[model samples]
Target chain A: MSSSANEAAARASAVSEMGRTIPTDAEVPHPEGVRWGMVVDLDRCTGCQACVVACQAENNIALNEEQRVLERRAKTWIRIERYWEGEFPNAKARFIPVLCQHCGNAPCETVCPVWATYHNNEGLNVQVYNRCIGTRFCANGCPYSVRYFNFWNPEWPEPMNNQLNPDVTVRTKGIIEKCTFCVQRINRVQVTAKTEGREIRSGEVQPACAQSCPTSALVFCDINDPESAPAQLAEAEAGRSYTLLEHFGTDPGIIYLKKVDPHAEIHEDEHAHAGAHA
Target chain B: MQEPVVADTKTSNRELLDFVFAWPAWFFAVGGALNGLLVAAFVVVILMLMFGLQFLGYSHPVYWGFLIVNFVFWIGVSHAGIMVSAILRLTQAEWRRPVTRAAEVLTIFSLLTAVQFPLIHSGRPWRTMYWTFPYDWNRGAWPNPRSPLVWDPSAIFTYLTSTILFVYVALLPDLALARDRAPNPVSRAIYGVLAMGFRGTTRQWRIQTVAGLLLSAIILPIFVSVHSIVSWDFAVTSVPGWHNTIFAPYFVIGAVHSGVSAVVTVMIVMRYAFGLKRFITRDHIDSLARLLIVVATVWLFFFLLDFFFGLYGTEPAEVDTWQRRLVEPPWVVIAITFIICAYIIPVPMWMFRAIRRNFFWMFVTTILVNVGMWLERYMVVVPALERKSGLTFTYGDYAPSLSEFILVAASFALVILGFLTFSKLLPIMPAADIKEGQILADRIRVGRANVPAAMRE
Candidate 1:
């Protein structure tokens, strides 16, 4: 067999292996084209929260005041979740960015009575702000706890209000708002590509979180397109890639590359401790 | 069993119609107070509309709290009507005669109060039409049938409509009695219209009886399904503490437990308030207490099953949620209080005949049962949301705000106010039902004693 053919076969086997591990029910099927997804490299994430700030600014998110944070009602579309690996002397602070997975069979989509949240053709979980009646059922349905409720009318004081993004809707209080993978950017890129009579290039559409990540820990791409660099990278590093809460069978669009820990024993022990705590 | 001493038709009419004819001082006082609280609730709702759900104790993760608990609690209370009127009627339980109207009336008022919670609890209560109304014509989008929130309204509205019909059907003869006995031409005409031109005839009585029976049979499944659907609001969710298979039966049985206990509480109040010494006797209360013992036991069984099954899975999230409920400070206190009030105190005391027959003890204990049931719902709802997922960093505690407390208090006041208004307009206890029981009363001689007996159809 030719070397190119052998490499092609290896890629196909790796993709199949990833698919086999991620169990999906009949309700969720991989869409035929332009499936937008993300690959987060935990090894590279510095827990700086730059993506969180970028997401807030781009999405027109409500100002999460100190009081709101103290009350545990702060709305951050993307958050850096910090975990400690070991006790006291040997402790290692680990960071993982948590956001909406935009699942193929999204639990949030199914639970919204008014069809306020739904999966678009582009594999995007779209939330219609006007349609929501604030039942919060979708929030409870989500296993990831990424969905955030707007408890109060958004306030940006005087000058900060001027910085609000015109591209994104400022969600009113009482409705749910969550990570939409910066859909406004996607729409802009798609419309621009369509106007020029060309296909959207790989890596052309970048979410605010991915765009602002200084270390390039977050990579956004069209997962269905085999030619996409990030898609190929995910397949190339297939052994390390895993979805959040894979047991849920949500068929999440976001993939995470496991944090490379040199001390495997400490990581294993921490896993056991987390299991007991859970 | 000792046969109840049935009152004569004239005496029954005068006694049952007393509250309708005259204004009692306590009635005005209590009604005024409840009205004041309801007004406060209305103000809070208006503030919520203006300010957003910030008035609520809702936070990230713990999105639902007191209002949802009250919704479930009132829905549970509404089950009293079906359990007392329908189920007892189907079984032909003799003690159900005087208690049926009060229970059914409680159902209507409680349900009316219950439906309001889901509306007011929403972030955008004004836009609740999008959730409730059948279609969105502008968008050509219908409400998602897959959602339990959709099923909730369909189930609750059906239960409410059928319950109204059930009460109205049983109320016709009583309305006729009120029409004949009405002090003024205004009241007489009002009662006449409500009575729907019914005259005492053999055929009409037969049809009325059959209709009542048919409604009783038809409403039984709705009664069961209503609470089961409410249970699914939590159970169908992937939330660990709420996702148990036993939630349906647990909620249904718990509803019956709290519902019947509420019935007993209402019955005792009706007995003293209307001077209904003859109709709502100790024997009636005893029979209800006996029914409650079985219901409470079954509810406890279901509660244990839900708790046991929650831990049985041994999924970290599930175990963590249970731990929060069972071992955590405030939640542990609530769980203990719930067990004590819902089961420990009342069920054991109810096992004794003396305690069951005593109106004071029955009233206090039944009230305790409802308190415990409310807390039980709170424990089931809030703690689970506090520890919703394995991402422990996101876990949060919820404490209901002042607005939430006010709304919860007003719900009780609303049910009481509704019951009082209904009592003032019509007989709270059915005079027709009491007279019917009187006609059925018989005496049979056994050995040296003349035993009072019932002539069953």
Candidate 2:
């Protein structure tokens, strides 16, 4: 070949090789036989807001005061949704922790004008905080009111402010925010695994609520990885496990174990927790 | 500075133009302030309660009344502006020209205000982005497209862009006029930059008119769609009153009803404030009242249609919603009055030439229409959920908390503030369009098949 042609060939090969190389920066290295998810066993959950507080503490969600809650301005990244089933005497309150069900087919992702929210490799729903223009489109679109907006500049008293997670941004007024299933923690686990040159292990990188659950009601694991506990539990509890607002065609990431009605057969006129069978 | 495209045909010009445009700001400022104070008080109370609840928090319903009401109210208020602007422009309503800017401006600003509730509604407005898929690190995560919240940005964004483009395109010739007519250098420069080098030549007029028409055509469906989508934020849910199929059109007409009324109110203020007896004449007011009356009737029709559909099926929850609105133990009569005030009262009052001619009655009807619309929106939303699952949370009443009310007040105040600032800069009327309109009126009188050449210049 002519000298110039040879040079062109070498340049082309270098470019192609660069293109083929793996991106070291933007990857979530999957754990060996693991996928990330939450499986709440409704039978065990008593609707006590322990998981909500635990998640809030771990994630540094803002404290929603009465006015905020009254204004429905209270932001609970993780909330225990109670559904009434049956009538008064037989009413059963079915309690479930509803959060960003990091859906496999999340509804919030598609409508982002700036593409701020997207799905991660590990089946996680992610929000790029900086890219989001506080339009609140995603919040309105969600079937579940899981998404929250920061209406004003956030406030914290002296010294109490020190508790904010450096990993998460303290959102300003006008932008939307919600649960990431503790993605910062997930990123940390992946980074640790990366430097060690090993894949993530099962039971590693558990979200704060799942990690702190006293009843072990909230389970996290890779549903894709059949060997993972969440996966196994999901399969074992096939009849009981469900996702919130399943009819909306938003295949949510979080799986909920149906609030068990030990009294389903007996409970009648007194059903307080009605599963949104409505 | 706006250019003089069309000559003023009226015997009197400046006195009329100046006055019609003045009062909305003053009235809005004071009205906005009083309303703002009320809303402010509401906000403070909510904050006190939310914060105060930590010590002895009640646990019956975590997410309760005020938040839900605010969402519904603000969203409802947001509907009127864009829909009225876009639909009128698309349908070729010249009467819209004087009022469209205010209406469209109302839409964009109101949207800014309404969407705030969700975030502030969250006790913690911080860390709201967890709903979006991925952060800037490009971890390949993004929001799911199927969700309404996701869809919401697209809808609102499209609406905002269209509204802005419509506002800008319509304002271009006026801006050029402002530039030409500027009494000072600063005004000239400001108008020059804003006008984007517009000159009222034939080609520029043709191009702008075409663009304006196209933008209006595009925005019409978009304005309608935005409200429909907003309705879906509720309708898509399995909730009884929310999930009804009639929500889309119902919302559209309701928006029109509210928006048209708002336009009337603003116009009346403009008439008295700016002394615009000629530019915004009795014909314009008559035209406006006629349109608003139709909108009121349609709002009533859709509302009744939805009511009947619910009553026919007799679904207990839907029935309960109707009953709570119309026949419940509470002041159902008051609810009926609200509807009548919004729909029933406005039409008859507007129909009579006496009422249409009388500025006082005109002003009264305008205020009544908006009040009625707000009440209708409340009836549609709060009552549906307040008594979910066959149980009424009667004690759990909704009054806007202090902060939210303040913010709501601030939103109106800001709109007026923004308007006052905008008026100080831009021409209150489309000087070019009105001048051209005068030329057109003269041409038709002269038996010319074509527009007068001077007007084109």
Candidate 3:
């Protein structure tokens, strides 16, 4: 081969090696199988709302003032949705903590005009705040109704301003906001593990919601890791575990265990835990 | 041999030219007031953007409210220009001469108005420019092609550019006549430049005619694709009511129905405004009304097809949406009004020859049809999102706020302001085409009857 031709071949190889460093879908099958997931135990949840408070503090979500709530414009990244079961005299209230599901086949990611939201290799649905033009198509496409829009600029009065989490951005008006499973904490843990020259252990990353759950109802871990709590619980509780809106084929990462009640009737008219979804 | 038809067409040419040359004071007074109102509303909208969008009344499930509905409505209204001008011209309809210019102007102005909704509706209206443009050399980012919203800018920009060129190309001959008859040097200079040095030579006319025909042919498919893409904006989404397969044809047919009706309303008003009753005869109004009846029927057919698909489909979400829309309180009333105004009443009223010929009744019926079509857009956009499926707990209602109402009023004012300004600057009657039509439309006597025949040559 000529000298110039040999030089071109060497340059091409170097460029291809550099391309490998920036992860492509083919390069990153997540060889470690590090797919993050969550499991919510409906049987154990008492609807105390400690997780909601924790999420707000960790994510720097806007305040849900009384007037904003009255106007039905309140922004909440995670909230408890309550549905009543039967007749008023014998009614039972069910509470489900609804947040972004981070679906495997996310509808919100496809409809976004500017690609404001996308799915990452770790099975995480990431929202690029700067890219969003606030078309609100993503919010409408979300069947879970978990995405919230910042209708007004976030206000942090006096001393409460100091409580703001520097890790997460304080979104302004006209943008959609949603839960990220405490991605800041995830990044921090990954950074520490990398610096220490070690792989991240199972249960090492705890989202604020999971950590604050008083009854230990919420658990977050890498489903790809065989030793992870979420993976084992998802496998062991297969009979009782099912996803919300499985019929939609969203394939969400979050799974829920059915509430256990011996007195619950199985009949045509009355579904035992249908109220939880409703 | 000189055709007798030429003599008759000349009688109104002077009057037609005079109508545009003389700018009426009352028209300016009215147009200036509308322009002032539009400027005020725009200022308010910008101020609201800075403070927050809460004033628009958009909430969780009902995120797209009046802004989107107004967008679709104005775009549908813009469709009339293509139907009346290009479609009628290609078919060689003689009566199209007096009405085509007004309708084309409507299309241009309304489309300009419609493009604003997406910009203003953006949460970050300022950043929308960067978001839509496909250059990310610095950021290493590009707009997602998979998105229908990305497709919207390309389609609307193409439609706007082509329609503007179509209007200017067709206006050249008339502009030449204006340049020749200008009483002042300033008017002569302005009209001369616009005329682009046309010498009225046979070769120039031949080239213009071929270019016009070619442009009309190309614009036809783009017109169809533009609205179909707009419908896909909703249909591509998984929202229960919007995710139907029938949205494309339904929106297209509905656009024609509203567009043809809007042309009739404009023609009748122009007849009085320009005193061109002899030019835009009662025959022209009747033909447009007849065309409207056919469009309305086809629209009703598509509406029924969509209704049945939603009603009988086994999908629980689709069925629930249809049932709730009908049985629900305010929506039930809106549905009833949409039927009466869009189809039931206007269709029957347009059927009668006497009603179609009468200017007042024609005006009232066309206005009713537009009102009904606007409601149809509202019904399609708002209700689907209001009752979006999956989480029944989050389903809610939408009510347009005072600011939204102001924005709607401003959009209408902008359309009128644009049309009035164009009329003063150019001859809107298509005098040259009308003379051509008159020459071809000589009377023919067949046995016992005297009938008008337009010789194709």
Candidate 4:
């Protein structure tokens, strides 16, 4: 083999060995000190659910049929939750995207009997599908309700079956699954960077949801990397940026920028009037 | 202390051994029905394994359902054994003699039944060995010690093993009795092997008594720890209604309440079914009822404390969970039923001596306590998951499916069937223990009445 190829192979082996040696305790950081995170700017969100569709296709998620939704058993890794401000006449629609926050102190990580779910050094809350015994304890432990269990084996009919993502595993029934922040894509980027003997560049590791976002609301980054644009954005927008369920002490990787509401007081007054009139 | 008037040793031995040696018609009828339900449950479990957990009514947000509720209920029922046998044995309560073996048998069967629900409820029941077994089958990955699910099996199995030993150590003399009275050579050999050559010598009796006492002391902590660990399965979680500090004591007390009530139910059934009326008298029922009044009241106190702590926190998510349990339609009904049946009606009724001693009323009340306790566990498990967090959009309600119902029914059938099968093999009421009690029986004159008493060793 060529000298550079040999170097790449050695580096890859070393990285694998490092991964194997890393303590299972989530408090430990990655050797590379990389913590993947996201900053969602609520101001730019349109609640169009493009990211949700993109995530489903990229992650080999089961197609949610009408019956599944009606039964309230649908699996949507990234969901846009809509809320209404004020009454019907003066009603204003608001949307916030919810996904696995991949917390530094994830509640879901501790409850799995088989270590089916854990926080990797990269700060990703990883769910090992094959290892899961489906106690659903992790799902109950999660405050965000982001973890989803496969009630039934996923089915994709006809041509859709061919579209399954080769990069992701089609999770079997009885195990839990959730957004991995598209770890497959992250791995690809890492491998590509390692092969060429260089560090991964900022903006190169976009998850499917962030990649498909039309308004650039979702920005994936290594939050621990000061050079990352999303990290810088979160730092700059500190006044508006907040994590969902801040009181939970989960210390989530996802930082959300609050939606700028100019008519906040007016909406409150209208809501009060509507309540009184009713 | 009031002791029931003891019957002659020969009569007690013959009467207790009757069910063991002869197969009563009702045994066949009830055992057959229970086996049939168990078969149906086995088929459902097979279907679930073939298909998926979709057979159950589990939806998003509400992952646990009737299976977990039944698991907790049966675990609570298993507590009857140690509560009656070990505690009474240690305290030297004479009335505990006839009830001890039956309670221990119930514990073993119910625990055997209880451990299956988590396995059956899992998405991959076959793969659960990796989680339940202590060995690191998957490379270097041992079962997570941090998880309460790991603690559950450890506590439960320890309790199961110790309980079996407790029952066995106490059963040696009885086993020897069965051996001497074996109907056939084959039966004689089986009993002979189980009896371990106990010839009822003074040394053997002394050793047996000492072993039983040692085991009782050893199992006391296990008895408390088992339910506490089970409670930690919920307490360790962030779920609003479940994450209370009072869960350990609350769960332990509640388990004893349900468990003791189950013993009362079983003793009453044994009285009729096995013709054990002489051994299991109204006085035993009266004592158990008096015990129930205290257990049920203490359980109520813990229940109220759990409720008060939930409200006192004033956390919105916690408050919302409480509101859902109290104000919500179906949950409110369940809460009310749980309260009235578990404490309100039975506790007060138990206060009246006439009610406590009446077999029929005691039977009805004890069954009601178990029903209420079952609903109590249901209230704890389901409502918390329904209002899990302040994320109202993600909140969803759970209903157990037909499959879940079948499996739960099957669990009850499994325990009953096991107990019945055991009854045929061994004396349901310990013969040797009863003989010893009869030896110690005495009376003392008090005022115009002759009060029942026991001779001190």
- Give lDDT tens digits, candidate 4, residues B141-233: 678888999999999999999999999999999999999998899999999999999999999999999999999999999999999999999
The segments of candidate 3 whose C-alpha lies over 4 angstroms from its true place after superposition are A1-32, A265-269, A272-278, B1-9, B443-457
Question: How close is chain A of candidate 1 to the true chain A, as a TM-score?
Answer: 0.86
Candidate 4 falls in which docking quality class?
medium
Taking the true A–B contacts (Cα pairs closer than 8 Å), what share appears in each candidate? Answer: 0.78, 0.07, 0.72, 0.79
lDDT of 2 by residue, B321-344 (tens): 677778875538658778778867
lDDT of 3 by residue, B254-282 (tens): 88888888888888888888777677767
lDDT of 3: 0.82
lDDT score at residue B408, model 3, on the 0-100 scale = 90
Per model, how many backbone clashes are there?
0, 125, 0, 0
**lDDT tens readout by residue for model 3, A1-278:** 67975675566456456542222343233445466789998888888999999998899887888987878888777788787876889888878788889888888988887768877768788887877789999998888888888877898888999999999998988888898989999999999999999999888999999999999889998877778777888789886788887777788888888777666554323542342332
Error of 3 at B318 (Å): 2.4
User: Which residue runs of candidate 2 sit more than 4 Å off their true CA positions?
Assistant: A1-119, A123-265, A268-278, B1-10, B13-248, B304-338, B377-399, B416-457
lDDT by residue (A1-278, candidate 2, tens digit) is 67975675566456446542211212333333234788878778877788888887777778777777765667788887676755899666666677788876665665554556766657777776766665454564455657776655678788969988888778765556788888888889999999999988987978888887889899887777787787788888887666765556677667777655655555533333333331
TM-score of 3: 0.93
Question: Lowest-scoring 10 consecutive residues by lDDT in candidate 1 chain B?
Answer: B1-10
lDDT of each: 0.87, 0.64, 0.82, 0.89
lDDT of 1 by residue, A45-67 (tens): 99999999999899999888888
TM-score of each: 0.94, 0.64, 0.93, 0.94
Candidate 1 lDDT, tens digit per residue, B382-456? 999999888887888899899999999999999999998999888888778777777666567889997655556
Instruction: Name the best candidate (by DockQ).
Output: 4
lDDT of the structure predicted as candidate 4 = 0.89
Taken in order, the candidates have interface RMSDs of 6.5, 9.1, 2.9, 1.7
Evaluated on the second chain alone, the candidates' TM-scores are 0.97, 0.82, 0.94, 0.96
